[model samples]
Target: MFARVVVTNMGNEMFNDGLFYTEQAELHKDQQFNKWRYCRSAIICFCVAAEAELAKLIAHSLRKQPHLSPEYTEILLFLTDPNSDKPIPKKLKNIRKKYNLLRRLNGLRPQKPDQRYMELTELRNKIIHYTFSSHEDVYAGTILDSTKIARDAVRDFIADLYSIVRETPPEWVNNNSSIDIQ
Candidate 1:
């Protein structure tokens, strides 16, 4: 009997969903209703996709370590082991924590995520916990820019992950196709 690894495909699915929403937004640009809805959905999907892909890369990096403490091994197994029964750490649920953890696991210095990642997260949070303030303006042009930023940021993260792991990215991961959003 051999150990089986389990990696979820949620990342790819979420990415595809984001692309779908982007396409829908472009297709329905002529409509008078729900012009921003698709853009909002796409931003959320892109953010989720980035988080899922980051977790996958971290798990992969952890598994490749030649000598890791039992604590880290436990985390790795929790992510990649099909039979793992270990409880995941609460902090690991946070995207920032996962990003730093990935860096540390790969023998890299942990630092704050870049501006693009920060922008994506901020946009995602604002949309997810929408609070309409009279002082804040939501312009169609700004929303379109945010949507583009979300897509580009996630694509950048995927490319960076592949570089960090020194692995060739899959076709889907490398396909940073631009959406023709107006």
Candidate 2:
């Protein structure tokens, strides 16, 4: 008898959404209208997809360690969250913490988040916490550049995680090719 496994669709769906936003940003990269919007959205979606996938990986790893006591498991689940008073189910960890936990669970060596991950995270934060006044230039090309960085970051992040887990990444991660944005 073969073991049957069922997985949720949200992680992939979010990744695909990021791809869609990337496409939109590319299509409008040369235009002034909505290009910044699309680029910003693409960066945000990519970051979200990366975080969602990491969370899913941690959750799956948690499932494999059935020997852990319920209290210990809860502690592991919320390890990144500082507020211990919060309900276990409601606590959430930031992406870097989640990655660290995943590494610890797999007996991997500890390291800081890599450059690609930091670059993507910074891009996501820059756009997400938008300010009204800034000396930074606001243009379609500039925003599109950030979008491309985000696209590569998420792809690399996913590939690296899959490699750590000894699993093959999905087709989309490898299939991304540069298309003419104009």
Candidate 3:
């Protein structure tokens, strides 16, 4: 009941009541199943929220100037602007549509994300879909697979964003790509 109240409050915040539902099969001897596992969301939300924030920062940095590599530019499109909830520059908007339409998004996105973005998307999907509860769960591909994908997605976005800021040397900016490993 304690967990239930918390989940209810969270649901109201996200405006997605379904987020609180936990299946009967998920219940254990003493613990009740919730539509969501607070621990999971608590942990995963930080990662997702971080990615969202980085996306915005990258977009804002890139938007100030123009003419970046096609691939880097693609990522900038999904990034948010600093001033508002507004999206990346109008020119960069195709990534979202392209990614959604494409069957396999490895190299780039129309307005969504690139291979790195898609990998992160898959990781987020798995976490959001409740496939992380046990070792025997069907997605048994490898926990490392999702973990590595998300880690690398963050790394790659940072690299590209860094490169744009460096290679072009945005006025008043002074920094190099902090990523050490490729």
Identify the candidate with maximal lDDT.
1
Model 2 clashes, total count:
0
Pairs in clash, predicted candidate 2: none
Best by TM-score: 1
Runs of candidate 1 exceeding 4 Å displacement: 1-8, 30-33, 81-91, 133-141, 176-182
Q: Per-residue lDDT for 64-104 in model 1, tens only? A: 88887877777877777789777776548677788888888
TM-score of each: 0.77, 0.75, 0.35
Better of 1 and 2 by TM-score: 1
Instruction: For candidate 3, write residues 38-111 as lDDT tens digits.
Output: 32332243244334434444455555545667755655544432344544544444334422322122223334
Model 2, 61-126: lDDT tens digits are 667775766654785566445565657442244556667767766778756766887777876776
Model 2 residue runs over 4 Å out of place are 1-8, 69-72, 75-92, 132-141, 177-182
lDDT of each: 0.73, 0.68, 0.37
Question: Could you tell which candidate, 2 or 3, scores higher by lDDT?
Answer: 2
Error of 1 at 92 (Å): 1.6
